[model samples]
Target: MDIIERFLKYVSYETTSNEESETTPSSDKEIVLLKELVKEMKDLGLNAFYKGGFAYGDIKSDSNKSDTIFLMAHVDTSPDASGKDVKPRIVHFDGSPIKLNENRALDPKVFESMCYHLNHDLIVTDGTTLLGGDDKAGVAIILDTVEKILKRGNYPNIKVCFSPDEEIGRGTKGIDLEYIKKDTDKIYAYTVDGGEIMGFSYENFNAASAKVIAEGVSIHPSIGKNKLINAMEVIAEFHDHLPKCRPENTEGREGFIHLVGMKGLVERAEYVYILRSFEKDELESFKNAFLESKNIINKKYNKDLITVEIRDSYKNMKEVIDKHPYTVDIVHEVYKEMNIPCVDWPIRGGTDGATLSHMGLPCPNLGTGGDNFHGVYEYLDIDEMKTMVQIITKIMDKLE
Candidate 1:
């Protein structure tokens, strides 16, 4: 199938991952797309399998090429918005807002990036759901590139993986690194799961998550004075103690503590926070700040009212990619040769590559021509998607 056809088919699966589930995929629906991708790979004459909610496949090089490249893209969409019954539409841009329905429209004025896509065909949603182009576009590009290379009969060995629960930061958690190493001799890898056409990322935030529990003594209102403590008030106080210039107020290289989830009653309350920073020391500082707030809350209550536990999620990939600069240089050279401008920017959020790189993969990230990922404004520039396919093919050619 062509890139557009493949992309549209993949998005029709409604593979939105759940962060609250305990299964390997976090949602059974993800397996639907995983199985289809495995079948597609096999039909194309490549070795493929669906294992543990992940789709894995490989195509051998027809030529005597020793270097193996691994391409990865997640099959799951973010749960932040509805992914069910997504109605995608194709529209030609004329430098104006594209109306999805009477109630909603994709405004270039709000999303200035749309200006760059003028005169290009775009795949968009109906404004009620996300388009899932973030990584589905990546999936189509990898599949299309592999098909083209195989038809031509000369290329480096290529391995493809479609992971699940990437939107929840667990995409690579279940992947067996030892098995991958035993299966192929990997020289380089990249996640085709970034935003924008020319934008590539090696640097991402050092991430961690924290859960805070606030305990309170609940009593009747008549006897509440000096006898009862409100957990909701304590939770609010905890939040207030956090830096005012936090995630929403900061940008570019600056890190902050973002409260993602909160639920509680008067007797008990819980808050989930994601802490991020570009530097490890800075991330540590942010953690300390939270700890200090927790300390103050405990002291104010004169009891252990607030308790917090923090866990590391992933580190910056640049720390690993820098060791193998040639991996990035190759992509840059290919982009230059294809006359595509290369934009290297720090990823404000994490990708599967971030965790995979730390696990001895030395993987970086490449763009999939997606914009406004994880929301209703998401879109894919068809022209840019085609360009990415060409870029991948050229990278493989250079490897040969």
Candidate 2:
């Protein structure tokens, strides 16, 4: 199948990962797509395997190159939106408002990125669910490239992995360099999970998460006075106490603390926050903001009513990528040869590349020609997706 055909097929699976689940894939539905990927890889004549939540595909090269290039994309969509029963259709985006449904429209005025997509064929979602183009597009590109390269023959050694729970930041849990390294002194890995056509990132946010729980005294509102401490009210006030460094208020290297999930009542409340920054120190301060707010709120209530738990996630890969310049050097040589202007985009979010780099792989990130990921408004530029195939294929052809 073509790239677009494969993408649409993969997104049809409801692979929404559960952050609450402690399992490796976090959701059983993720396995449906993972299993299908393994079958497809085997059909393509690549030695493939499916174990746990991870899928691996190996392409043998006739050329005995010293370097083994690894390409990766995640099968699971983001939990922030519904990935079930996705209804996708291709639209020829003009410079006018494109209707998603009766109530929603893809207007260039609202989403400025739409302006760039004029005269382009885009695969978009219905107003109800996300299109799942974020990494599905990445998946299709890798698999399609695998097929094309094998047919072309005499290609460099290529390895591909499709992971689960990437949106929840658990994609790299079972993935390591040993399997992909196989008889090569140097490994060049790239995570094909970035957004936008020009996005090539070597850096991403240092990330962590904080879960806050507040306990309060409940009373009948009619008979309530100072004795009544609403847990919901306490949680809201605790949020207010922190600096206004929120996702909406920050951009482009300016870190933010974002509230991802919340549930509460008068007697008990819980909220989860994702803290991010380009700098380690800044991320530390962001984590501290949660503790500091918990203390202030607890002190204000004169009770130990608030409790917080913070856990560290992946760090920025720039520190490690800098140590191995060859990881990015090949990308530069390929883009220069292809005459595509290099776009050094820094990811405000994290990727599998982040954790994989620290795990000794030194992986970088590449764009999948997608935009507005993890939402109903997400889309994939069909032409750009095809361009990505060319870009990756060229990189493989040029690999020494």
Candidate 3:
């Protein structure tokens, strides 16, 4: 099948991960699609299997080389939006606003990135659900490239993995990297999970997530007078103490503290935040800010009613990519050969590559020709994805 056909089929599976679940994958639905991927890899004559809610595929090259090139993409969609019953629409852009549904339109004025895709076909969502283009597009690109390479030999040995929980920062927790490197002298990898096909990243944010719980006393309003303390108000105080560096306020290498979710009652409330920065020191400062806010609020109330928990997500992949310059240099050479006009963009968010690289695998990320991922306004440029398939094949041939 072609890239478009493969993408449409993959996105039809509802694989939104659950962060609250205690299970290995955090969700069972991810396995359904993962099994299908294993079957497809087997059909391509790849030694593929699904284990621990992750799928792995291996192909041995006829070339007498011990070097292996690994291509990876996540199988789960972001929990920020619904992935169920996604309705994908294809629009041939003509420099006009395109309607996605009754209440939503893919307006060029709002999304200036659409300007680059003008006069090209775009695969968009129906405004009610995310199109799952984040990594599904990456999956299709890898699969398509694998098929073509199988037809034409002389490529390096390839390893494929479709990891789960990448959306929730648990992508590399289940994989065995030592085993993947057992028989190989050197391994090179690319996580096909970035946005915009012309951009790739060796650096991503040093990331963490914080959870704040506020506790207060509750009583009847008529009799409560000075005795009642609203938990929501306490949570609000914590939110206000945070710096104004939010997702909307920061760009490029700037960091941000994003309030992902909050829920509360009169007596108790909680808020979740994701902190991101390109520098390790900056990320540390953000974590300190969370603790400082908790200190101030508890001092004011004269009670230990606030609790803070912060956990590291992933570090910048550049820390590892810097050691092996070829990981990034090889990609640039391939893009130069393809005349793709690629950019050395920095990732504003974290990916599976960041964690895997730090684990001694040294993987960089490639783009998928997509934009506005993880939400209703997400879209994929049809021509860009197809072109990426060829670029990936070129990398396979060149790296060998």
Candidate 4:
């Protein structure tokens, strides 16, 4: 199947990952796509199977090359928008505002990148749902490139993985690293999950998640004076103490603490936050600042009213990518050979590459021809998607 056809098929399944689920795949719906991908891989005569909600496939080289190149993409879409019943529309851009629905439109004024896509075809949504192009485009590119490579014959050993729950940051948690290490000689992997055509990322935020719980004593309103403490008020005070210049106010290498979600009643309150920074020390300082705020709240209440829990997610992949410079150098060389513009930029959000890089696989992220991901404004440039396929083919051919 073609890239567009495969992408449309993949998105037809509601594979939105659930962060609240305790299962491996997080959502059972993700397995639908995983099984389909595995069947497709097997039909293509590659050794393929689904394990732990992940689809794994391998194609041995016709050549005696000792090195292996692994290509990966996530199958799950973000829960930030509705992925169910996504109605994708193909429109030719003439540089005007493209109406998605009565209330929403894709405007060149709002998304300046549409200006560059004038006269090009784009895959978009109906404004009620996200297009799921973020990593589905990546999946399509990898699958299409691999199929083409097999037909031509004579390529290095290639491994492909379609992971689940990437949107929830658990994509690599269920990956079989032992299988990866044993199948390949020297593995060099890249995740085709970056946005835009030319943009590539090796640097990503040092990420950590924080959960704060506020405890309070609830009593009848008539007798509440000086005897009752409102947990909602305590939680509000905690948020007020947080830095005003947050994620929205900061950009380009500046880190910020983001309040993602909050829930509470009078008896107890909970706040979920994510801390992001390029530097580990800066991330630590930000985390400490939150703890200090908690300390102040505890002192003010004269009791341990607020408790904080912090957990590390992933670090910048540059630390690992820098060790093996060729991993990135070869990609730049491949882009130069293909006359594709290479844009090196820091990823404001984390990717599967960061987690895998930290897991002993020196992986960086490659572009996927997607824009405005994780929202209704998401789109995929058809021409750029085709170019991404070419780029992947070239990388496979050039891999030693």
Best by TM-score: 1
- Model 2 residue runs over 4 Å out of place are 210-243, 258-273, 287-310
lDDT of 1 by residue, 1-400 (tens): 8999999998898999998899999999999899999999998888999888889988777898977888999999999988888889999999989998888888999889888788999999999999999789989999999989898888888888989999987999789666556556547689999777688889899999999999999999798999999998998999888876577799988988899999999999999999999999988987887899999999988899999999998899999999988789999999888788888989998888989889988888988888998888889999999998988888888884
Q: Which residue pairs collide, candidate 4? A: none
Error of 1 at 385 (Å): 0.3
Give model 2's TM-score versus the native structure: 0.84
Backbone clash total, candidate 1: 0
- Ranking under TM-score, best-scoring first? 1, 4, 3, 2
Candidate 1 regions off by >4 Å?
214-238, 263-270, 296-305
In terms of lDDT, the poorest run of 10 residues in model 4 is 179-188
TM-score of each: 0.90, 0.84, 0.85, 0.88
lDDT (Cα) of model 2:
0.87
In Å, residue 81's CA in model 3 sits off its true spot by 3.1
**Deviation of model 4 at 302, angstroms:** 6.8
Say which prediction, candidate 1 or candidate 3, comes out ahead on TM-score. 1
Residue lDDT tens for model 2, 149-266: 8888878877889999988878988774578777666678898876776768999999899999999899999889878999999999999987789999899989998999999999
